[model samples]
Target: MGNNQPTEKSVSDTISDAFQPILETPILNIISEIFQPNLEIIPKYSEPPNYNKEVTNVYILKLTDDKYYVGKSNDPSQRYLDHATESGSAWTRKYKPLEIEKVIKNASHFDEDKCVKEYMSLYGIDNVRGGTYSSVRLTNAQKGLLTQEIRGAKDCCFRCGRDNHFADKCYAKTNVHGENLPPKKKIVQSRININELELLSSETSSD
Candidate 1:
């Protein structure tokens, strides 16, 4: 008697058999005819990534629109993936980075500072943010400047340019009296006599 056995199908054969009928069916043709082509074209995939992707501390992100975010991370690729998944920095998620614009070779935060400053200058301060040391320094500097501005306005008289009192309580309310002798006493006065009026009202009510 001759030996006989059934041959096993290959993976290619199995897959072909499964999809061959679907490919040959007229339903695809019917569907194609029934529906108009989609108006939106699928964008081509991004170019091949840099193979030498070392985790440099600083990276720039190009927003989907007109904005930028400079950042630092040990694993920039993973950080990017986090951004894509919406679990990364709130800025990156909100703006939606189109791509990692550039990865700095240096891990120094000073370099990050330079990048952040450049982006802020180019795109306007409102449009850019991030970096480790840069963020802190910028924030501190901004806060300091704002505080100084506030204090300067409060500590000097706009009318007389005196450092003793505010403009609202200045002796020379409207006069640009040039820098002269400082006021001997604090100008503890207001345009409205609220306390006197309130005192009069209280006395009248009591009477």
Candidate 2:
């Protein structure tokens, strides 16, 4: 009850609290405003350059003559226009392309190959020109040569230059198209006609 007055902090106590280390201070879930000296800076993620190619689509065009052409492109509309104008494919030009019937987006060449084969099976191989691979083209040409043979035509295959089962069942990997095959040597047989022989005899008798 004697000298009831509020006491103030001592000068030495205030000085010691002011000089305390910051690490000793209590904190609640606070991050630093600046980075550490030894920290590594990571760059943000970026897309690839061939991202468009990776997301390209496999599509099918329905011709006016009930045929189908399977292909791959990122822009199906432009590709369809090219086919409609008769600038895309020989098959499309011959059959008159109508419109795009199907489109499988984000497709690869392998996916295109499978789609083409499926279309070929659905609408006979002769009606389907199929995909744009070397194997597909070579196979179609071989089938054409086989059809020629079935029609009694003496046309050799564009691949091996042979008329028999060479083209009918050829499983060649590349589209050599008779490039590596040996050149065909022509056979000429000279036969004397009856009139020519009689004239020769008369000339010999007169001589």
Candidate 3:
């Protein structure tokens, strides 16, 4: 009788057999997913970006009316979008079909204002509206000087020559006589006399 012993499979074949399901399962799952009916794909939505607040930029936009508008905003792209989509400003609304022509980033607010004003001058004062371009925005010092000029009035202070303060409040007037002092304090004796007459009349009426 011939000795018959079953030969064991190679170690490599066993290892391959063990890993076959592991490798093939994923591929089969992928194929099933592809061929599956009514497959709903979950949309991959990215998170919205944070808005940049410190984007001081000057922008120039051209309108359908063949006019260019110079303006400033923190975000020029968003501002342009607003001018295009949002029907807010009358100028933009009337003009319509607006497009951004130029952008100057990282500009000072004052410089932006100056640029807009210069553009307004070049275009026409009536064509521009709002912002410092329409009115001069003065600094605190400039405002103070303006206040002084207004207070100076027609008659100027001879002492300091500063118009902001009245002559009575003037430092030079402090030493001056009656003219410098606010009109003398007058005691209204008439009121007291009227009160006495009223009391006397009431008393007489009671008698």
Candidate 4:
């Protein structure tokens, strides 16, 4: 006859194993509670900053006429308002009134002056700095010629200024051309000869 029995761990061993899981569970829950909110808030501080600086230089166009007004200012909005007012300068006064069609902003002082000059030149206005228009009328051919003259003056090509050959065939490269030719190489010539006496001796022996 055999007795049926169940193997069992000690009471202390059971308590120890259960106590470890209970201790570890509370630790994991506490760690998760502390870290989750920190992860959520970290992204908010990492965003980029925004800048809203205002532009200062501008171009004003008249809506009703062929005239365009180009000028520079530290404050473009104020300048435009002043130009539209009743006490504006003689140029704006003669035009009777004006409307701004376009505004170019944030140009350097030199660039602003150049832009104003170019625009005045295009519209056949003289004394661009003071907004003075000349009464002298230019024919189309004359206008084209004047434009070319101004452009040539601005460019001031050396060959054109010197009245020499054009830029494409300037003499500056003449010395450089002489230096580029291939250096000379020496060659020796030689002649080859066969002796008639040796050939005759071999032929006689063979016979």
Per-residue lDDT tens digits of candidate 4, residues 1-207?
Answer: 676676688999889998987677788786887776756656556655432243456565462356555665676667767767735455554453356656666755455546655665555433232222222343576544544554454553233222344444444432221323223233578654468767988999999
Quote the lDDT for 147 in model 4: 46
Error of 1 at 42 (Å): 72
Q: Work out the TM-score per prediction.
A: 0.38, 0.41, 0.36, 0.35
| lDDT per residue (tens digit) for residues 1-207 in model 2 | 697786788998788888676546544322443433444565667876775556678889888778888888879899999988878887787788777899998887678767765665455556777565323245666766444443333354545445554554654444323235444444699998999999999999998
- Checking candidate 2 for backbone clashes, the offending pairs are none
| Ten contiguous residues minimizing lDDT sum, candidate 3 | 173-182
Arrange candidates by TM-score, highest first: which order?
2, 1, 3, 4
lDDT of each: 0.67, 0.67, 0.61, 0.52
Over the stretch 94-207, how does candidate 1's per-residue lDDT look in tens digits? 788789988876466466766775676456555776764223235767844433443454465444545767666666634233436455466476786899999999999998
lDDT of 3: 0.61
lDDT of 4 at 40: 60
Q: If ranked by lDDT, best first, what sequence of candidates would result?
A: 1, 2, 3, 4
Best by TM-score: 2
- How many residue pairs clash in all the candidates, one count each? 0, 0, 2, 0
TM-score of 2: 0.41
| Model 3 TM-score, all chains together | 0.36
